[model samples]
Target: MDTLLSAPILFFMLGSIIALAGARIPFPEGFDKALAAYLLVAIGLKGGVALTTADTATVLPLLLTAGLISLLMPLLGFALLRSAVGLDRVNAAAVAAHYGSVSLVTFVTATKVLESSGVPFGGHMVAALAIMEGPAIITGLLLAGATGVTAVAAGAGGGTMSMPIDDGRDEGRDEERGGSLREAVREAAFNGSVLLLAGSLLVGLVIGKPGLEKLSGLFVAPWDGALSLFLLGMGYLATSRLREAASLSARLIAFGLVMPLLGAVIGLAAASALGLGLGDAVLMVTLCASASYIAVPAALRHALPTADPGLSLPLCLGISFPFNILVGIPLYVAMSRALLG
Candidate 1:
């Protein structure tokens, strides 16, 4: 509890408050987008620097685990939503993929907290993070494909089959292709987050620690300051979106909050089985526990247009996101230490 109320969390809360209150401040919305780009770059670069700290042997196993989690968890999440929630196939799968995937902001904050508390994490966790984003996006599309196939089978000679994705600000667009699994794979692999993360990873690998250390004085030096400013913008964005829409259902809220815990526990077990240290375990749990608000939502909007974004995004960014960043992280760290140590 004392750990949860530490300075970093308080800084985050302060940023959230500023974001919610900054509506009248005369900055252009485009400025916020630029801030987001900076945040992403900073995060990617930092993750790269961290990766440079890893030995070769530790890197492979953690990277492999990250990839497997990215592949497996989304499929499991989709199955659970379909069987239990009765969401249509595409919607269930899309939401499942988002929940299964990673959140960059959450990952950044977790790393900071771990470092501040003097917990040593593996550098390859960033590799794990970079690897984690694409799989869930692929799985969501696969789930959508199954839905499309089922619809085709059931409605032959009857009606058109449409699978819609919903995001709160606007209606989603379809992937603009049909009847080719290869195209789906291409779309998933080439998504924006994958491009950025992969680019950053390659840059980091090429630059190595010496190069990163030179740039770190600028990019890494005021990271907390940058994150606070960025998260404040996020808070404003979140609150404005919330004000524009109605509140979410209790079930959806529960789903958002609880599902991450399940993912974290699963990740803890996986890390322990793989014999990861405290830092790696915490990062693994954090990645599993964090839900994607950016990449998955964008993919879902294109691939599943009819689904409700109101249900998905709010539950994810609004409810679960805040809970995980503020509360779930500290709890997960403590739990990982207790179990893995």
Candidate 2:
């Protein structure tokens, strides 16, 4: 509870409340994105600076574990969504991919809390963040394509996927495939947020402690205050968009809440096996618990055309993201303390 009373989190709550009351968001256009970019750069720099002293030997195993966890989540989410949640396979795979991916803001918030509490964790976790994005995305696309079909209806949000018509000519198909490959490359490589995170991390790694000395005022000191404003905006965005998904089924709504806890459990258990300390274990759980609104949605917009952002975004942003921000992180930290201690 004390954790929730922090200035940044209080700002998030205030944003959600104001949004619920239907107040107009005061932040200018692109401000929210700028905040996000600021956060990624700050965290990436810190991660890089801390990583200067990290044991190279342990980094590889931790990174490999992150990848393995990312791979498992979408598969698990797909199975649950299909059998229990009753979503069609196309939507199921897309949402599953989202579950597999990490949310940068959520991870950043968790780290802030850990830092405040004086908990110790490895800097390699940020590298783990960068490493975890791609596999789940590819896995989701394959699962959708396994049906060998996609059919878009006449109107927006009309329906889910349909079988693709078989064509004799392979020429145009090759061109289309080539274009999709290029699109995939952009999503993986050129996403502005992820690129900046990686680039900033590399800069930190190169600059090391000397860089930290020069930049602490800009990046480190103001982090929480900046995050407060950022989450304030995010709270509004998440709430305002809830109306778009008001028609969602109760089971799907439940899944949005339940999936994160399920994921946190898996990630925490995995971290335990890998001998992670309490703080990193909590973060690992937080990473698995988070659903990617940015990267997966971008890829799904292209890869699974018929997959509804109306559905996926609400589930992720409206439900899971807030849940992680307000309740889930605290719960994971407590769980880590109990288990790890």
Candidate 3:
């Protein structure tokens, strides 16, 4: 409820509704890329700095649990989509990848909810975040039996990659060769968002408290504002294909909505088993509950060419992202509180 009222979510919905109503909100060129980098770096830096004082040994279980949850999530999703929903393996795997991966924006939004509630979460969660992105992607690709296809760009926050990766051949050659699993793996591993996030985390670890404090003026105070603007841009991009969501079969839409809940339940189980505190538990639940609109989609484009973007994109961005923001975050928080407090 209160989560729905926050500025970031409001801006997201405002952008969405505005776009839905057939209006345009212009942003400066490359604005989204800048915001995405800043957000990921800030998240990494904060996590890294926090890791300085915290006992690293304890963080291991949390990271391991988060990774296992991420890997397991998509397998469950694929089975449900195939058995109950009747999607083919490729599409099911594609959509499953989304369910398995975390949405940085959604995590950020959940953090805001915790902040408003005065709850504190561990920065080691960022280390968890770093490991969480790639495994689900690889799992999805493997389950789909994707050898690989053409490369596509997904920025850190902009949904575009930072640099173009040439696959040792021109586009025509790439199409003919049918890029290998290695290519897909590379995309998942070095994705702009993932690379920046993981890289920044290392940088943060190396720099520690002193470094974070020196840069606090930039990354700390103004994070929410940057996030709001990026979400607004994402709203425009998401709604660009908004009709895809509207066009989805009822079952698919239902899958989009339901998968997040199922994911969250498993997340809660993991948290309890690991004895995570309230804040980390909430984030872990949110992480599982979040479907990736970021790295998964890009990797899927290269990995599963036959997989329909229409279904996957709408489910991830349109149905799941908003549901998590408006309804899921607070619900998961309550679930955590019930379990932990």
Candidate 4:
């Protein structure tokens, strides 16, 4: 309970409350975008710097594990969502990819808490971020394609599924009628958030630590301040949007809350098998446990356009992300120690 009421969650709550009260506090949308960009750059640069400090030998095995987690966890998430919820394959797969992927902010917050607590973890986990981000995204596209087929099969006779009519159609008409699912898949993959994050990471890595050191003040110094302001705006936005969500679907909420715990267990067990130390184990578990808001939501907008954002966003950012950061991290830490000891 003490963990639940910790400073981080309290700060988040304060943001939520002020937003719910309908205070017309002006936060420029451009400022939010700038803040997001700064955060991605700062975190990516920090990750790259930390990677530069890691031993290549140790980094390789951990990198392999991170890559494996990125590849496999999405399938696990997809199965769970398919069995637990009635979500169609595309939406389930999209949401599954998200659950398996890491949330950069949540990971950053966990790192801050661990540092404050004087817990030790490897710098190599930063590389894990780079490893995991792309695979889940690619998997999500495949899942969407699979779901589109399922949709077509299910709606075959419902009048929604259209067949290419063959009333002596011309070659141009035939070509026009035969649209492929690859196009939808491509659209989802090349989204704004994925491109921004991938681009920022590349820039941060190519620029390296020296380039980042020159601008640490704006990116590093005021990071917490920017986060606070961003959260404040987000809290207001969530509250305003979620007023109608009190009666929202409970099944989805439960899924959002529980999946992180499951993911943490899988990640922690993998860490133990690989002989990861306490700090790395905690972070690995945290990464598995965390879900993406920025990347997945954007992908889902393109992929699962019919999926309820009001239901999805608040469940992810408002409920699950905060729950994991505030309470789940400390709990996972304690549990990892007990189990792995």
Best candidate (score: TM-score): 2
Which ranges of candidate 3 are over 4 A from the true structure? 146-179, 239-241
Cα-based lDDT for every prediction: 0.72, 0.83, 0.81, 0.68
lDDT of 4 by residue, 236-310 (tens): 555655564465567777887898999899888888887888888888889989887776666445434444455
**lDDT measured at residue 229 in model 1 versus the true structure, 0 to 100:** 66
Model 1 misplaced stretches (Cα beyond 4 Å)? 1-8, 18-28, 149-184, 240-246
* C-alpha lDDT of residue 338 in model 3: 90
For model 4, give the 10-residue run with minimal summed lDDT. Answer: 150-159
**Residue by residue across 1-341, what tens digits does model 1's lDDT show?**
65556555675566566656654445576876666666666667766777766677777877888888888888777777777667777668768888878888888778888888898876577778878876877777676765433222222223244534344422122223342334445655687766776777678777878888888877788777776666665655555555533475555566777789999988998889888989889989999998888877665554555455667777677777778877898889989989976
Which segments of model 4 are wrong by more than 4 Å?
1-8, 147-213, 238-247, 303-311
Sorting all predicted structures by TM-score, with the top scorer first, yields 2, 3, 1, 4
Q: Is candidate 1 or candidate 3 better by lDDT?
A: 3
lDDT (C-alpha) at residue 60 in model 4: 90
Query: Positional deviation of 253 in candidate 1, in angstroms?
Result: 1.7
True lDDT of residue 27, candidate 2: 79
lDDT of 3 by residue, 305-331 (tens): 666777888888878887887789989
Instruction: Give candidate 3's error at residue 260 in angstroms.
Output: 0.2
- Cα distance off (Å), candidate 1, residue 294: 0.9
Each candidate structure's TM-score, on Cα atoms with residue i matched to residue i, is 0.83, 0.93, 0.88, 0.79
The TM-score obtained by model 2 is: 0.93
